[model samples]
Target: MRRRKRRFLFSTVCTLFILLAGLAGAALFFRIQGKIGASRKTPDALFLEYVECLSKADYTDMYRMLDEQSHLNISEEDFITRHKNIYEGIEASGITAQIGQVAEKDGEAVVSYNMSLGSIAGEINFSNQVKFRKEKKKGYQMVWDDSVIFPELGRSDKVRVSTDKAKRGSVFDRNGLLLAGKGTASSVGLVPGKMSEDSAGDLETLGNLLGISADAIGKKLSAKWVKEDSFVPLKTIKKVDELNLNSMEPREDNVKNKEFQDELLAVPGVLITDTEVRYYPLGESGAHLVGYVQNVTAEDLEKHSGEDYLSDSVIGRSGMEALFEKELKGTNGRTITITDSYGTVKKTLAAKPRVDGKDITLTIDSTLQDEIYQTFKEDKSCTVAMNPYTGEVLALVSTPSYDDNDFILGMSEEKWASLNDDERKPMFNRFRQRFAPGSSFKPITGAIGLSTGAIDPNEDFGGEGLSWRKDESWGNYYVTTLHDYSPVILENAFIYSDNIYFAKAALKIGYDDFMSGLDKLGFNQEIPFDISVTKSQYSNTERIETEVQLADSGYGQGQMLVNPIHLASLYTMFANQGNVMKPYLQYKEEPKSEVWLPGACSSEIADRIQTALGKVISSEHGTGHAAYRNDIEFAGKTGTAEIKASKDDRTGTELGWFAVFTTDPNLETPILLVSMTEDVKDRGGSGYVVRKDKAILNSYISGGR
Candidate 1:
């Protein structure tokens, strides 16, 4: 037993010795492997890591990788700033890299790679090389240089940039007359840095010529810490002749005289630079249609970042200008050159020729627009005329208009405030403003009644006298009372605008069919146009508690509101033979037309309605008799809507409206006209609207002839 125990102890001791030996051998092997792994890292791998940092836009990581020599050349802050400038210039948030093979040259390592930078101009792809040197402690470090960002750059070469501004496009009328264009104008101002003499006297002379206060000019030019070269713009004058220097006597007040003008131009601080201004030759004729431009905001810069828009760039603010901004604002060109330290051009590296903006031609006739503008000078109203067949708007005029040139010429705050405070609301676009359409809406009701087979064209209601009242649970059903007209047929009802007869006709059509017919006519639906428009609304039948309420709506007296443009578009059905043409402002546009109520009416029904409309203008007893022309035949309807008075005790004002269309063979297409005058003082009903409508149409027809 003692011999066996001694043998087991010897075996266990040998096993323990072997286990200790194996662990020591493994530790030594791993140590040698780690050293070998460190020695295997080449400059190629270090360069790739740096490129990866660039791909990720990790500037801080890239800064850390720079050698002592590179750090000495550029502080970390300066490095960050330089990198940021490059990123913004190229608009580069991320980079795409194609790594090339790294090779040894003259005991140093060189890496070739391709980089693609994205900018507003386009993607700029280039090839570049990075050089590295071996360091005893650091293993390897890059030799930093400006060429790291752009391969062609050098120590002595500096980058110079120039912008070639593209000329803004011009706006032309149908006759090729210039409406808005770029023209040379005077920019009068003070250059603080250029002024070495006493500016008080010069400023006073300048203020006199510019019609600004001398004290105001002094305050602007003498502001604290103003740079010597800073230009303080006083005004942009388009018609220099209107400055009236010749009319001013030298001794009369402080206004400058013609003789002193030359002296004023010679002043040290005074400046009269010739600059481009957006000129409106037609003035306020079509101001609402052809908007104006304004300076860019910070938000505009952010939104158009890649487009290379400067902070001071001008942009369209409204109307057609805003609608076609992208097309009107042509691509601006850039020229980048390499310059010496002394600012001398060393080489012209790149040049991009600027492409000017394209011109725009409108469908409007400048002659007709100007004539109508002058005709409506005395009235506060709205007028819209369109070709019923083509749906091209010939003239869209709103009274109480403003001269858009005032805005471009830098209108004063006081002037802007006065405009806003005007009681007439001149800036208000009445073309799109909603109003109770009155008798103008009767044609739609008539169309609906005849098309739906709700009322017979020849059937007579036996002339229901003046007022209409039906026995009802709700109070008096007298929606409205009209003057007595014999034989209340569809023809007489429409010709005389007999509300009593039509109200009964709408009730006979039943609530569902009446509303359904309106639906077919596009009531309560969106009228798509280039400019914004308020949707015409109909009374919600779901809440229409009584028949009287519905009856009032049937005769165009209750909750019915429509835009002038929309009303004109709807009238196209009569002249277009049941096809409602889509209205457009731009010329030569083939807008799609839709069939109105295919299931409701045939062409015969539309023709019959056209005849009744003709009688409204040609017939002796017609309400639209004033619009009747001796030389041409036309169809029309008149309306007088009651508008609520501003004061509680005063009676409601009358709104006169007239819708007319002429099928004169002399014209290329049928012209439909819709005119409305609110708060009319004349109680001649539609007579006032017809007289004005006739004058405009007469002028248009006479001019065309």
Candidate 2:
């Protein structure tokens, strides 16, 4: 028993001692590991820290990681500034790195590194060596130099960047007529050295010819880089081609500019030279359709951060230019070169090939577009001309417009102010806008009435004078018409433009049927066109809350607003067997027709309305009789939209509208023209617009676009 107890005690003591030894070993190992972790980085690690700092553009930290010798050679400010100037100038971002082999010799080392940087020239990649020197006190530190920033860069070398501008694509009409394209303009400049001894008089003459003030010319000449012999461009004037109507260039404007150019040549120190320019050949005739491009502002660059745009880049501002900007603006090329103090290229760092913009061909007929613009340029008007069968838009014109070329050539402050300040709202794009469609909307209402089976074409709504209301429940407001015609059938109402007949038809259709009818006709829907316009709506709200509002909506009053393009599309149903054609701007081969609303009305109903439309133009007593032509059979409707604060208030302006098309689709070029003019209240109302469009129709039918 004594031997067993003594053995057990010895075994327990041995186990305890062994356990304590194992714990001591673990503690010692942990202490050694902590020391390793807390110690200064290895030579390769220090270089990696420098590179990681470089990736983040942390120049201050990177400078701190340099050795004493490097610090003595360059100040922290200089180091940071150099890195920032080169990196930011090239728009560098998205840096990635890969560390290669590190070979050490004695106390110094060279760590191989491969880095990638995203820049305007695309991805820049290079493999280089980073030097590390073992310091007396700081351990391993980087040896900093300009070469660390870029392998091709030396201490005194500068990085020179050059941009190759891509050729902007031309815009053409369906017949290959140039709309917006490349052209040359006269660049009027002044050379200080060539000035007369009486330089004051010479400056005055030069300023007058260039349409600039003497002080403005003086300011330009006083620029920091302007030398005595330097030719400082003052302005660019439009050049005209007599044979080119496609450019929509106004002959008078060009002639005036030519006279100025000639007079400028007579002035001492003045130089007139040709320079390439982006031109809207259509000028004021199609200004609202083609749009213009201008130099990029700081705001544009900030908004499009990662885009390819540079400080001096040009961007589309409005119209077709803005609509197709992405495809129309080609990629610009760039080259980054290392240059010496004298600006001689030492090495090429990176380069990119230029990509030219794609050309655009529109379905528009420039001849027709110009003609329509000329007719309405004196007034606030909007017009849309299209081919009813093919759904191809031929012309979109908004008048009281500014020359688009003025934007590219630099418009005067006075001209710009006049446009904005004009109560006519010339800057307001009418074709791209919505308006109270007036009586032109009647055809649509009539078709909707027939489609819903709420209207009988032959049934008489009887005589109700010139104005009417749904019932006594509707107070004050009444549906009004211009003419009171007897036996008011659908066709007869169309001929006389009787609003009461259509109003009664709408009341029978009721609210639910009317709203549903509007939905089928593409109300509250985005029209599938390249350029966006506000959707057509019967009312601002979804539901019709009153009988009077519904009655007014039937005659294209109340809140019945529509886009000219959409209104033109609605008319296509009359010519296309009850199908609303989808209007397209971009030209396609074969000119295929696309149905936007299939069976908006029945074929028989479309024919009945179409026949009534023809009679509206042909009948002697018709409101649209002013546009009757002996050469071509025409079909059309006239509308006068009353803009009133109330039914009793007669001081509001009126919108004159005329929607017309040819009955002969077999003609070489079938056209549907819809025009609307503002402030036509006392100016013959819809007749004013009808007369203006008559000339266009006559010119079109006579092959005189």
Candidate 3:
């Protein structure tokens, strides 16, 4: 009886403890639930949650948040897809939403908010209100519609970006002659209605000829927008007639292309049509300068990701075409609108006005450019012509060039291979490169010597024969000149192009002063021009180390290298009466003379050098006398740069140079032309280049240019 009483008391205490613990657990659970329920469930808060989903681009989550009315209008799958396509299509990002205020109307809660986002066209911002309704089953829920995605959008409206593509500006020469402009190209396409019944074989043939898959073509034909009579353009090709102009028969590859097209045309709806394309009017003559444009590639799109570039857009590939790509490419206009089911625009969300490309007018004279290009088109050469007084670059020519139009129209694989395999390297832009200026560099040395007082205009340096070495430190190397003259004064040195005289003069200028004077003349400095030309360099190293190196430099040989344009610009010092005029290619303002390198020479020294250079063309036995014209006074110099293994080596090739300018300032065409050619050995040396320049000058002077 005693044990039973003890057990019953223990059970009573344990039951009391369990009942108290259960009561406390119930209280804690209710408190947690109350805290969650206490959080704002107002219309503003619920709408903010919906906006939060939009900011994250969580379309599926957004679809679930929509009210029953919205679900009734659009299915869950279509709601998600529409939002995704519209957002991704415009490349939208950085979405933000801020709640402004809340109001109640007609028993419904309206929350006002301002939203903003970024897109490819620009920023898009709007103010809108979202409504929340009280439902019997779900106490409160946010109401949504197409207008919620974008203000003014309707249930039946379509959201899309309409692009108004800007026309690419044309490139014109000084006289308004077109260098690069718009033209027409051939497009290969098919008419769906005329397609063969058994198109499997026909499509295979067409696909192979067009260099695309048959499945791809089939998909294009089956597109909803493509009707039976619709013409489905497949590929763009070169204008057949233009590509085969010079030849009586089409090229082997062209014949193959034509035959392929003919076979396809016989089978089905295949046809050739015309489409607009970019044309290079100057063709091979202005190829290097005008360059060419091609369709943008994936890499191009990435490189210019934030710019107004479309996959089908073209970008400048070379020459001035590339240099001024930004200025030439216009801003494309865009309109994001809401359209109805009938394709009628209902409302515009955002719009950007289109700005057409700026038409670029250059200082290049097409006639002069073409004339100069024709003179050396068959040789490895480069030439630059400019108005010496004004520093306007009139023409820039590089020989053995490829047709830039061919690049735009389309070039065959075999043709591309031939261009690469040709020893001439037609695609190389020679005018933009630097080369040993040879004797053409003599006038710069003369100016340096005369301005630095290292050389007196009339001071005689006695006789040193045709070859002389300073103290025999040069070993077998000796400064040699073609003509032996007595009294090596500045006049005789320039007239005869005496290497020994200039070499001795360079030694007189010493290393420091020579470099300083050269710097003053724009050497080792960036040339300010539209095109990028390599800087003229005096030596490979910072200093002219040895006596032979210094001597050779004085004659424009040694390790000296100069850009053709830079060389042409340097001569402006004489024409401008002591200032190196800044060279320019754009025709923005009046033709004004701007000095590039001031104080390059004193006026007196310039006149003296100018007279001496004139004698170089007029005086009998003068090195440049062969180019003399009785009607016009020409000042010029000739140079033969020897490329030898050693000072005694004679088998090396030679580079010929001729730099000439008209002394007559009042002359209708005052041009300073510089021409250089490789492998001038035994072919009249620098005289060969001189003769070539003379003809171009005569043609230009006679108004042919």
Cα displacement (angstroms), candidate 3, residue 424, comes to: 0.8
TM-score, cand. 1 vs. native: 0.85
Angstrom error of the Cα, residue 687, model 3: value is: 0.7
* Residue-level lDDT tens digits of model 3 in 250-346: 6675666666656656867887888988988788899999999888999999999989898789999998788888888898999887788899987
lDDT of each: 0.74, 0.87, 0.85
Report the poorest 10 consecutive residues by lDDT, candidate 3: 238-247
What C-alpha lDDT, on a 0 to 100 scale, does residue 376 get in candidate 3?
A: 94
Query: What residue pairs are clashing in model 3?
Result: 439-639
Candidate 2 has its poorest 10 consecutive residues by lDDT at 239-248
Q: Candidate 2: where are CA atoms >4 Å away? A: 1-40, 208-213, 223-228, 239-255, 258-266, 340-346, 465-467, 475-478, 482-486, 703-705
Q: Across residues 1-705, which tens digit of lDDT does each residue of candidate 2 receive?
A: 999999999999999999999999999999987776544578777776776787788989988888999999999999899888888887788877788998889988888888888887778899888888887666788888888877878899997778998877889999999998898887889898988898878888777656689999889989999998899999987764445534566567556666666787888888877899998878888888999999999999998777678787788899888888888889889998889998999887789999999999999999999999989999999999999998999999998888898898888888899989999888888898899988899899899888888999989888989888766877766777777777889999999998888788889999999999998888999988888998988997878777888888888988889999999999999998899999999999888999998999988988899999999999998999999877777789999998989778868999999999987889887999999999998899999999999999888777532
Q: Candidate 1 or 2, higher TM-score?
A: 2
**With candidate 2 superimposed using the best TM-score fit, by how many Å does residue 78's alpha carbon deviate from the native?**
2.7
In order of appearance, the predictions have TM-scores of 0.85, 0.88, 0.85
